[model samples]
Target: MKILKLEIKQKPFDDILSGKKYFERREIKPSNVIDYVSFIVDGKEYEKEEDVPEGDSEVMVKAKSYDRLKLVTGEYKGKRPYLMVEVKDAHVEFLYDENGDFIVGVEKGKEYAIAHIVFELGNVVEIFKGEK
Candidate 1:
């Protein structure tokens, strides 16, 4: 089977990050905005390679001109806050094996900042950028 991919357009972090601040007011919708995962700590660079926590919180994912997708939040025993992205498919193969257990591997791919969302630009090949 062929793999589905997405692409994130190049834009400044301010433009992308601004979309999240108003997701609940129905000001955002899914269209073609870039998706990324990121966190702010002590005014320093916090990479997604770190672990996240488990919780019933919402993670806002905004596209440049699309509706923002609210995602489920999770946590880990280690440092850093973790956010989960909503995937359209249930591809079990995309998951990761953490010490003999299966876990949603959102950060398994490349690392890029799309619309303030932290993700690898390479993993998102066709979905956002479209197929060739």
Candidate 2:
């Protein structure tokens, strides 16, 4: 399995940890070869997505919830992945704001346009809190 590291803020992080948010929507899609990915939250390793296991109820839930989707974005880098996801199923389509522009990030009342990326997270695979 190929592991990718993502830097996320507190709100989205909390949403993911609480199971309130499942998909990590981004303007850029990962390489089609990636099979599994991981995120570090408070020093804990959370497995966002993994290969579809035949008889695993947990994995089944994820597989059933998400369909193979993709969208195009700005320039991006491609690397080898463990599993190959189709380009069409890996891209992220963005919704335009009222100004007919994509909002990348927001602070105060100002919005910014920038590239973004998403990742579908799974269960916690490892924990590294309070370790040296």
TM-scores of the models, in the given order? 0.17, 0.33
lDDT of model 1, residue 124: 16
Write candidate 2's Cα lDDT for 61-130 as tens digits.
1111233222222223452112212221223345567898865655456454433344555553343222
What local lDDT score does residue 10 receive in model 1, on the 0 to 100 scale?
A: 30
- RMSD each, Å: 18.6, 17.2
Q: Count the backbone clashes (under 3 Å) in each candidate.
A: 28, 14
lDDT of 1 by residue, 63-122 (tens): 222222322222323432212223232210222355754343233363322222232211
